[model samples]
Target: MSDDATPDATSERAAALGLTSPAAEEGAAGPVRFAVVGSGWRAEFFLRMAVLMPERFAVVGVVSRTAERGAEVTARWGTPTFRTVGELLAATDPELVVVSVPWDVTPVVTRELVEAGTPVLAETPPAPDAAGLRTLWEQVGASGLVQVAEHSPVMPAHAARHRLLQDGAIGQVTSVQISSTHMYHAVAVIRRLLGAGFEPVRITAQRFAAPLMNPRTRAGWTGDRDPVEASTILALLDLGEGRSAVYDFTDNQWHNPLRADRLLVRGSHGELLDDRVTRWLDGETTIDSPLVRSQSGIGQDLDGYDLQHLSFEGQVVYRNPFVGARLSDDDIAVATLLDRTGAWVRGQGEPPYPLAEGSQDHLISLAVEEAAGTGQPITTEREAWAG
Candidate 1:
């Protein structure tokens, strides 16, 4: 650990690693005023972020599908709620609107917001399936008013690794293996690491079942101690041009303690497995380094138990923009997405994650499930969004 490294040396190392603190990258843009179009469990992530960092975000209003839901949200958050998007817009001029409805309703809400000439930050898997995705892309792909809330690539650890790959720390990234979150979320990380963009892919997959104890979930523990049958799906994606990705997922892996998340990025010069990176420094020199995280309030420290930043080889690779917010890594990623969306809507930053990219991730993920079910290889074709 190079905690005592000089500032100049650390800055040089950080530049070499292609690391830029988020605050430095995106200048302070002030509080972003936005409204949410749904009141589901996922919508609370956005609401909670506003509550945690009121200086950075302001939830202008919430648009629930029903008056009861709107009242419930207003009762809990004390933020005004409306029964329709039009009502929310008429009351509050939010800079952007977040669409967090169900899978089937996402495209509709997104289209409505787009037609209203409002910038939108839509939830993942912009559409339900391939056909829906194509149709939605045809309607709004060119409007440049939509950004998908794909947060995996922005997670601190994953963001650090992506920066390293971008800097060629590990020569040219050839392949990636991810066994983290399920479906499109994992695929988003794989595509980001490989720098794959709407490329046609050939996928082969298989599913297996085994008995595993299931305890915890996002909701909490299910006291049933019996081992239940769990399904695991493994897939191989060939994205032409010597690039590939391995997708592995198991039911309840996100919360199951028995299943640890894993990631592997193999490049021409080296490979990064989880937090440790092994790379060739010279003809005869191979170096290994671990990604170190700085957490406050541990033992002697009393800064109130929060993640400060992530560092590699003494260089700060990724710094938590909301240091004192005390948010988890996942929440940090989501909040970053929200912040970037606000910036993009104001034309201050690049689009966080475009809808086309999210569509491709889901398209590939859907093919994986299809391949596993049919026991046959599946190849994707170019879609409307690819153009």
Candidate 2:
């Protein structure tokens, strides 16, 4: 929720969305200084954001396991790289350290950082499996120095839908159907839209295989013309009190051109299908409103090609904070996580996403995999972090 308007303008927009206006921006502060602990693909996202907005974030250093990898990162990003966390920390004291390593190594690095009294922004899952998650929580859950970089809830479209739900535009949200992402990512979106906390859930799932043509991926086009077998997992997560979520995902769905993302949020008064909201305003009147996006660089518009804002029924619900950065929607979400993490570390805002929340999301996701493999219904048990 970034705005370049005056206080009056911001207040009007907030009133339109039925929300109270927030306080004005605080006094100017220096850029957030941080470091990275890995040099993989995910590590580059942080470096890229810093490159795009140098005044907002600063990359103090990066840690790579091998000297060759460190040299490559230094050459590309022009940021100094070290061989270990110890060397990076010894050289520069970063306010926060981002752990973007593999799943198995994330917990170890996070623990090391926590023990050193350094705040951490860990990548997704936080651990590899259930045992690792429980152990990680038992070790660092009480430290209050860890936050997970989960970005689904802050994505533009999802953010607008969340505002609509919170404003009671569709009454109380009862269930959500997510076919956009898989496993933990999907679960995170479901839980956020449902306003669900750390409660027990009953999960049932199954996997199916079918022949589909995936001509594109994150790398680019595959150039192959043949169809290959891919797996699709469907699960029903029963979060008691009549609340539930339907999780549907196909293999490589995130990058496959053959599959389109879909979402549905049902409430007592009406339902939201993707960007459209259909609800009854009165006993005899029902209306449909579509979430419209204002993108620049279209036709004669000269603000460059970027997303400016998202509005429904003439009211702005979501605004792009990094408008001039020209970032994709996914990148925007990740950048939001980075910005919020910086604010949290400086005591300027609340924690963005904590380790307890990330652990629960992965806990249910692992259950989805197990239920599909064993053809049985799995019920989650209370964990130490639930307290």
Candidate 3:
């Protein structure tokens, strides 16, 4: 902790580390008490968020299947570890549990936690396939406690666009062209941007190939692999009412620096292409402004590089809640999910990303992949969880 730490930071750091502080109890008032199942790379995101935003989150325990891995996580993160979900639940009373395992394993752990009456913040692609999704829904769809942590829509840049669309800054949204992320992740962003509910839609998609250099991952990039031809998947989502979305993504687009991100939100009266917004203020007037971002701790600011917020036209649309945490936009989004999940569990807010929304996103995503592979326009159908 720094000498100039905020009161919340001081108390939270003390409580999270089990220091002899007034707030270090099991039912502490400050941080959202939670635990995680799995200790893989994605699981580390949850741990890092808790560590960075101690006031907003607290990790009670991590359930690892193996003793060696559990010991490794314990030694590294100083978080208690249990061998089984049963043991973890018995030992620590977390208000929520985050399922950060592989797709196949996600439903099982989520089911266990939901059956035990604990709120769960599940990872993306809630299940492996549509059948898995239906089966999982059959088990826990009505529980009203599972919220998937799909961070793209809530990511700072994307969230700013969402806010702008919701305010009708560009008039009625007509279409969105997204070239960031892939598959289900891209679908989540498109759905949110288009304001499309769980409505049935048709998808026409195809895959193309191109050569590109692959560099970097969450771990590191040593330029170890040779440059190779990568495939690009293009999908057209025919959202009803003439509203539509174009999904264009290349393999490793998430980390590839060569492919610049492109976002074009076309509305009836205006359009937003990336940071620039072109909209009509009146019949004879058109205005343009850039989505400005405020960052702290870059030059004169000693706090360190942290995303402050995003604003358009002097109106603050997205404000980073975890300031001075040195987190990226995506990290902030995940932290928001955890914090909101906590609030929902405590009856302070609505469910963040309900299971139905995630299922629908994946539902369309699976259709896109199928359409791309089969050269056909596939239509979506209402699932059991859809409203």
Candidate 4:
């Protein structure tokens, strides 16, 4: 944590993360006023989004723990940047706050924001571990003001697979299978598709202390706690209803990273195998699912992350016949969902990704991590999610 972390936590300026439509009378050019809570790498992405969509959103204020880093970003973006949350809030009054700090800092930041009456779209894992995530969830339940927004779940690929299953492209899903070891994303993708109302019957994880080839290990990237590199985590999730998904994430091959991500969905009627995401009507190509894979550079909000490179903009798996175009169905779904979510925030209509519905995923992922840590099966309450 940075030196001013303690003061930032206790300060009243560390506003929460969320979106609230300004009075209809506020009108255009007024923009959706926002203040980013961090000036780190992730915060830079939100800054870029504000820059790209100036007509819709404006980043009027920012707070960073590091004085130098804070000044640098403020100078570059020409926004009011401060060393503490109190300073940032004292300088500007914005309608929305976007939290873009690290994973570990999320809970404290969230609590402060919620208490201060700010709505947040905090970054993911929700927290570093299960207990931390539960605490954040409980905090949000009590606050009644903060909004937990997760992006990867909003990344297009997962959204498409979700639609295929819901629309009955696959028969009444008797089973489900997700294959990936990326931990955060794998668990999120699985729960989103399984409708967040399913229970886990079993979970098993295997780990190996392998090396990862990255700047974290080579250059001491963030700090000591950031694993220079350690690989070896393959987990299999067994869900009743004859559904299952295998998660394979080990750093063994990461020393020499390969095609990093992949997902396959099988159902009674069809299967979306690998990057193609093709399904067969009676196992024939003529019946292939007609959804276009939305790989990198396609429909990127016209000019947001791509030109700025503040955030990653590419498919989870690249199987495009064209180089650099890793389009897939899962990609399309997530992209569409994000558009819908943004529109909802702008008061155009309701969001496709329900906030309450999405919370269930966080709960399930927490359970998976617990099962992995304990080497045991954990069960979730299906009926409890009836909200």
Per-model TM-score, in order, reads 0.92, 0.93, 0.92, 0.68
Query: For residues 1-387, could you state the per-residue lDDT of candidate 1 as single tens digits?
Result: 001111233234334434322222323766899999888898988887776666677788888777777666765665778878887787788999999988999999899989999999999889999999999999999999999999989999999999888888899999999998999999999989999988789999999999999988878998879999999999999999999999999999999988999999999999999999999999899999998999998999977778999898898989988887778898999999999898888788899998889999999999999999999999999888888
Winning candidate number (TM-score): 2
Candidate number that wins on lDDT, 2 or 4: 2
What C-alpha lDDT do the candidate models reach, one value each? Answer: 0.86, 0.87, 0.85, 0.53
lDDT of 4 by residue, 81-178 (tens): 67666666666676656677787887777677767776555655456765665566666755444444555554544544565567666565554455
Per residue, candidate 3 scores C-alpha lDDT tens digits across 47-98 of 8776665657778888887888877776656678888889888888999999
RMSD of 1: 9.8
Model 2 stretches with alpha carbons more than 4 Å out: 1-27
As a whole number from 0 to 100, the lDDT of residue 355 in candidate 4 is: 31
State in Å the error of residue 343, model 1. Answer: 0.9
Better of 1 and 2 by TM-score: 2
lDDT of 2 by residue, 1-387 (tens): 111112223334334434332222333777678999998998888877766666677788888888777767765666778777887888888999999999999999999999999999999989999999999999999999999988888999999999999988889899999999988899999999999888999999999999999899889999979899999999999988889999999999999988999999999999999999998799799899999999998999986788999999999999998877778898899889888999999899999999999999999999999999998999999888898
> How does model 1 fare in lDDT?
0.86
Q: Which model scores highest in lDDT?
A: 2
Which of the two, 3 or 4, has more lDDT?
A: 3
Scored by Cα lDDT, where does model 3 land?
A: 0.85
